[model samples]
Target: MVRHWWLILIACWSFSLSADEVTDLYESRIEVATQSRDDRQDALREAFSSVLIKVSGQRDVLERPEVSRQLSQATNYLVQYSYVTERQQLYLRAQFDEQRIEELLRRANASYWSARRPNIIFWIAQETQRGARLIGRDADSEIVPAMRRQAHQRGLPISFPLLDLTDLSNLSASDVWGRFERPVQEASRRYPSDGLVMVRVQEGDNGQGYLAQWTLIVGNTRRSGQVDTEDLNGIGMAVVDSVTDRVAAEYAVSYSETEASEFTIRIINLQDLESVLLVESLLRRLASVEQATLARYHQGTAEFRLQLIGDMRRALQALELDNRMQRVEDPWSVTASPVLEYRWLR
Candidate 1:
């Protein structure tokens, strides 16, 4: 009887010790999970803090303390946690950063004036013939008008008036100097111009439908040496297209570098909120975003009043809902009420 009693007591003690060991193991797991969650949260907070500083500098307008605080909190939450899948994570991050994205868009408008204004000018061509009744009637006649129209469309300022063929016929050699040269010289004198375009129609074939050969002169220099055309209209269109392309090329090359910088900065700020939110959602239940009111006080601390979508219990439950058994941890907490005493360290 004494041996049996002693055996029963030993069995009871062994069972109790085993139970205690199991309990300790469970507690240890919970503690480890809790500490892991805390560590993740800290890492997320630090990343968000760094990004927020970059955003602040990029923003053209100063952000209100409350707004900055809310953004930081949301970003921190997004960084710390993630959903079960990459797709779900993406969705949540988008939802979280929607407001900040809007703010960045507003800031991007500040770069509108950074684009260089184009310098445009109008160009006119003058042609003179010794025996022709009209001043502009040579084979090059059709081309001059086409070039003028092209310049106008390209936003170039043009001042060439269409010369009446009769005016050319009426002018003698002496009047030629007075009529074309004096007017052009006066124009150059009064207005600043890049150059003048002049064309001389040396010959024409009426049977070939105004077929002509001509020399193109730009400011006192000859450009085509000589060009022959079966149709004056075709020549005019080609010249206009060529000139416009040349001008546009010059402007584009000169401004490309400056424009690229301005465009990059503008696009980044405009998209910052969306980008951050996307990154957050990709990270998911490990992190959750809440909309919150934020304000900065005189002391430099940022106060936040967060509003979560679900109740506290629901949010807390999310932290433990993963089925993968990957990691069990309570990653985050939100105050159920609108108490504003908690402040974020910048």
Candidate 2:
């Protein structure tokens, strides 16, 4: 049974990778009341505002004068648009030109979080008059939809525990509600993800609202916070927003109005031509890297020189967001020869 569940998760992860690779970063959707001309115009403006927040990873990006100035002309950047209905609600799906939006951000000197984002696994425990219960992928709870909605709005990739027999045997709702990192992490080992998040939801002190306390663990950083709201959806959305802000702060690169600089990186354990192509593609996809070229190649080792729009430190930081590249620490490492070193994980 555990093996079956693991296979399903692996399949899902594979499908999501294909989706993420082709996903448009500048596309957004906004709910609208009718198909009137005024409503379409208003929806496009609001949709662009959402895109700015998602792409820049800055909640206040629309508040920037340069960015706000372009909001009135949001339709000028739209490459395509369509109307879609979901759950009987109409939405305007707008696909804006990615280059134009990035250029606007560059002019605004805003932060840019690339489409290559961290996939976080969530473990949520909700307490009520009945008792405590865990929310899984198939859980019939309002928090699930609320969390998914918020994560999608912010362009975050999030997943929930399978809560199969194997999961139930390893973890309990009490364990998550108590914020026990050890057990939560132990249970999370089966899922392939970049980060882990645990949330505990209960009635607020005022007895009329919900309180969600969450802990996020990504790399060596740990962030914890609490959100109080009048309903479950608010608590879920607020928690996701808080988590996105923290993750984006670490991964997003600030656009600088400066000339591009060169940086060299060494990656070992590249055993095939496909790995080499993938490495170069990943480097080239980063917003910080203007261009990436293979400098040299040896037996199972390759060095790539990158023309970066940002500093070397920030470029390396952005590359670290992808889990396939594992940083290799060398005691004798020097900046003059190789600025960064990593091992390509299969």
Candidate 3:
């Protein structure tokens, strides 16, 4: 089993948050709705495709030669599944073997994307029968739910602006539609995302398909792409998938980084046993952290020596969840030794 499986079990059993509740997409599982088991094989392929897209951050991963071959034998990789009926519809929750899939990806020479993805602040412009409008956080509009569903499916952490007076004072739909990142990012200060995706959607030249233009902005950088879809439901998903492929290309690491390395990190301001246990569990449960041992605890601090696998970026990304550990930013007061800045959020 991959180390992520163990982390999933521990998060489910010990943490207050469920595995699904975490923004980090750790589980290699996906649920598909079907009318009957007759669609099981197709569902198997779709589920595998979905999880693969989420893990590899490649929208075209299914088209890879080896991946395409495996899709024909998708059922062979299924670890287990359960059937549930909801609202007169049957849903299959399937779990695939992550280790096997990682091996397959390795054989294909594809790197594995870390779960610590950047939050994307989506600025979407929609042209409706009435007029064009921006999709805000609380617009009570039709497109918001559709786009959100797509975000959930792709396992992309996406958010929309509140479009309040503060935002209105700075930007308009025209700014978003124009693909202007300077003024847009200036307005997006409160949203604190690693990047921004600006989408402009209108009727196509044929007046049937959706004509869309998009750009992704990250730290003075921009990547642009377009998608023409007959349906509105998949438009946002298509844009997100394209930009994420680029982001993954930049950040993904090798899956073979499972060799354990000894590492020691210090935690400051731990007040009690609960804090110590919580701190240790946070590190030990990370997929990148093979195991963690408390070497000693003294003077409101704890020192842990850990056996680590996976990339350092991944370990840092796991620590970002729930503000468990934060990097020391101040240059002067920081210790010469590596210290993880943490505080109980009570």
lDDT of each: 0.32, 0.85, 0.69
**Which is better, 1 or 2, measured by lDDT?**
2
lDDT of 2 at 319: 79
Worst 10-residue lDDT window for candidate 1 reads 22-31
Which candidate should be chosen as best, given TM-score against the real structure?
A: 2
Candidate 2 has what TM-score? Answer: 0.87
lDDT of 1 by residue, 1-346 (tens): 6436533543343211111011210000000123354554454454343333222222222254443554445442341233222432321111123235334423433111101112222223323453432233232446657755544333333344234443334333333322354444443333333334333333355544332322222233333323455666666554544443443332212211222210000001112333323222212212122432222222333232333432333222232222211222234645433331211111
- Candidate 2 stretches greater than 4 Å from native: 1-22, 256-262, 309-314, 330-339
Model 3 per-residue lDDT tens digits across residues 155-196: 667788988889888988788878787778898888856678
Residue-wise C-alpha lDDT for candidate 2, range 1-346, written one tens digit per residue: 6436533543343212432332656888989999999999999999889888999987988888999899999988999999999999999999998889889998998988888887889999999787889999999888889999998989888889999999999989999999899999999989877789999999977688999999999877799999899998898899999999998887777885476689789999999866776777778778788877777888999988899875776677667777778988867856544467899997
- Residue 314 displacement in candidate 3 (angstroms): 4.3
Backbone clash tally (model 1): 24
User: What are the C-alpha RMSDs, in order, of all predicted structures?
Assistant: 32.1, 8.0, 5.7
Please identify which of the two predictions, 2 or 3, would achieve the higher lDDT against the true structure: 2
